[model samples]
Target: MDRKTKIALGGGCHWCTEAVFQSLKGVNKVEQGYVASHGINSNFSEAVIVHFQPEKISLKTLIEVHLLTHKSTSNHSMRIKYRSAIYTFSEVQQKEALSLLDEFKSKSDSNIITQVYPFSAFEPSRNEIQNYYRQNPEKPFCKQFINPKLQLLLQHFSNYVNEDNIKHTDQK
Candidate 1:
């Protein structure tokens, strides 16, 4: 069996992030939840633990997709609640994520504010609210907030997308 790795990501609403990761090909599970890093980031923030097989999808690709799907550059008022961060489980992942972010920054006109932090703790979202998008795809929140992210995924990273997990009608 292939070894699976997990990474926590936070940028936008957890619902949106969860759905976006769920639509990916190599992602085995997306745990929508709250995550806290060390130091100043001790407070829990909306995030998702994406469990995936690196052999099937590279971390570089996952990080790239994450950067594009959310407001990685924007330092908005709700940043406290929605931190722009990548919570890495290991030293290697941390270094790789930082390098990827730096490389991404070099190519962009705007500064990338996505922080790379060591994973500290995670509290899974309440059962009723977990997998919000898949259960409530027709709801306004899913349609308005999540559908676009999935569309962007299909547009730019279709090769890594699991088409079966996505409802094409939601893209309309």
Candidate 2:
């Protein structure tokens, strides 16, 4: 078996990001958390720390999935709290993330605005917010915002999804 690795990602609400990544086949764990931001005031962005097997899925693939599942380009009108970002724990991760961004930039029309920063700290979200979608599937926000992302993953990345993580009845 391959050793697992962890990466912290912030694309949007932690609840949404957590639910999407938790379904991936190689992902052993997805913890919702807050990562220190580059902005003033020492605020934190909602993020997820994902533990996955690199042998089963490459970091590049994970980065692709992340960009696809959330809006990486910033919208000036939207709050900066949920801006897309990759918080790297090492120089290798930072390099890899930049390479992916370059690759993505070359293939797309719009710019990839996802930020890459050295990880400072990760504060796990409260219990009520963990495993949110599974526990509150019927919540309006989950049905409205999260279900579509889940369906997109199911359709485009079926091979990466864990069987047990396929909880959407409509997809089944």
Indicate which candidate wins on TM-score: 1
| lDDT tens digits, residue span 9-53, model 2 | 987888889989988888999989888745461468788999989
Steric collisions counted per model: 0, 0
Scored by lDDT, the top model is 1
The TM-scores of all predictions, comma-separated, are 0.97, 0.91
Q: Tell me the deviation in Å of residue 1 in model 2.
A: 4.6
lDDT for model 2: 0.82
Candidate models: Cα lDDT each: 0.92, 0.82
Q: What is the total number of backbone clashes in candidate 1?
A: 0
